[model samples]
Target: MAEADPMKGVVARLDELVAIRPRAGGGFAPGGKVRTHQLGGHRSGFRGRGMEFDEVRAYQPGDDIRTIDWRVTARTGRAHTKLFQEERERPVLVLADARAAMRFGTRGCFKSVLAAQAAAILSWVGIAGGDRVGGVVIGPAGVATFRPERSRRRILSFVKSIADATADAPRAGEPPLAAAIAHIRALARPGSLIFLVSDFFDLDDHAVREVERLALQSHVTNLFVFDPLEAALPGAGSFPVTDGRIVARLDVDRPAARAVYAQRFQARRDAVERMSRERGMTFLPLDTGQNPVDILHPERLGAKPSAAARSAR
Candidate 1:
């Protein structure tokens, strides 16, 4: 088989993504560290905290003091405790960005492909954890939304939607990132876990507010995906860049230009991080050069896997 062109990594194939299912398991965790390229760790406090009242029974040893049922104890004339069970099917939403800006990369694969791959891996992990998986893919054509479902079939369908979104052509007058965030705010239920994978090029004031609102109801993890070139210029020289429609010359040779470019990128990152920090959400930076599977793995993220993690893999 011929190797695919790295320059033309425009779309993500369904079969290719499906093959990643097996590798998606083992040590992966949403709050895992990406210990490479100076990309630090992320923290997540969100869990299946949604508990339902099971019953009230006589208090026994090891019963939580917080769960003590005072009314039941008073009526029964004995110490009682309320038992609760965690919700089994917590909804997990993977929001992937497949806009035109994501179609460019200098290593591994395009940002769009990386976003889809990450989203697919997260979806598989969610399903494996006995949670419902769904997603929203913001493509050049528009947005595609899938409701959360616990079935593998539903996850596969959602994966296909993400793959398909990458192949769509850029359309004018399409909905912005804020619109998609707004859509997710409406679609997501309280306590839902949302993984937002994007380069965040379109994240503006409106999108920031929208994300803030979304974070209030759901646990949002911002996976900021970017290519190495976007963060810094390769050495110092003139380079040609294009935005699908127009081509322009980028003079990285000028120190002022390089400084400005780096500052802009840092500003964008700082803004996203600020939003995440304010909302108590997780903010992770993903380089296109890094493997999505390794990045998500709890114990193997850019590090030597432990014996237990190796056995699981």
Candidate 2:
């Protein structure tokens, strides 16, 4: 099959993403509709701790009897009713990595591109559900901020700015993962939903600790995008590397070199997954080679195999 253009893929996928609506609940239901309450915003009212029952008035003609506060009515000697306070809008932040290192793609597309796509989808989802959506794109130039807004246009603008900002970066870099995490911690308030997108290749223990701290204050979703080739280098012959003037060919066929690189990659991935689990975050493993929409909409992949079926493999 002919490879699709990356830019074209992004545009097409964005269009498809706009069409998706959350199910009746916030989760994706069988019918691709999310329950209204689950959409994650103020429309559902505040359902959490801050919510209080306002004074009940006489039962309105249409008021549900279930909501009547009988004890209040008995004490007041009137048909006083209960009114629960509604919730405020929940903020959702998409913390995306657009570092140079994320620009490499041995197979599929670049991790940076995938991160952008994921951010776009997530931002749109949050906005659609009536939540305030904002984010920061971390690249070599530093963190680019997009304050949370409910407008669809704002979400689109955020996604586009991220794409434009990272377009000029080199395909690799020593990203400041720790600094970015700290930035997120400062920017986001408690109880926000944070979607952290990255290859998570350069993150050190300090960065991971920062992420953990953020997790304590917010619900986090870690989306790890990587190329399969990055995990396992093919048994190809030595490949030539040119540093403009100098040309050097390094043999990857050597078992030691191959093993070391593979181990490092695997270890990084494992650490990321473990951290996510420990922090009670949802960890999604995505391959850049796969369709972006499919990754976001996993149900489209088909019925998930049962544990027995998966284990048999």
The whole-model lDDT of each prediction reads 0.72, 0.65
- Please estimate how well model 1 matches the true structure, expressed as its whole-model Cα lDDT: 0.72
| Cα error of candidate 1 at position 170, Å | 1.4
lDDT digits (tens) for residues 1-313 of candidate 1: 9996643555799997898774323322332322222111212223222356656767765455787889988888999877654433347788889988888887888899999998888887777665667878888888888888978998898999899988888777867899888777777865577888998998988999888777654567788888888888877877887765799987777788888888999999888877777666767788888888754653333334223223212
lDDT of 2 by residue, 1-313 (tens): 9985645432224443344433333432111222334533342221123367645567655355677789988988877657554445457788878776776664455677777777776776666566778888788777778778878788877776777655654544544888877877777765566778898877797988888887654566677888887888779697775433578986787888889989998999888877866655656678777766664555553424233212211
Q: What value of lDDT does candidate 2 attain over all alpha carbons?
A: 0.65
TM-score per candidate, chains pooled:
0.74, 0.69
Error of 2 at 196 (Å): 0.6
Q: What lDDT score is found at residue 133 in candidate 2?
A: 81
Work out how many backbone clashes candidate 2 has: 14
Q: After superposition, how far is residue 234 of candidate 2 from its true place, in Å?
A: 0.4
lDDT measured at residue 136 in model 1 versus the true structure, 0 to 100? 85
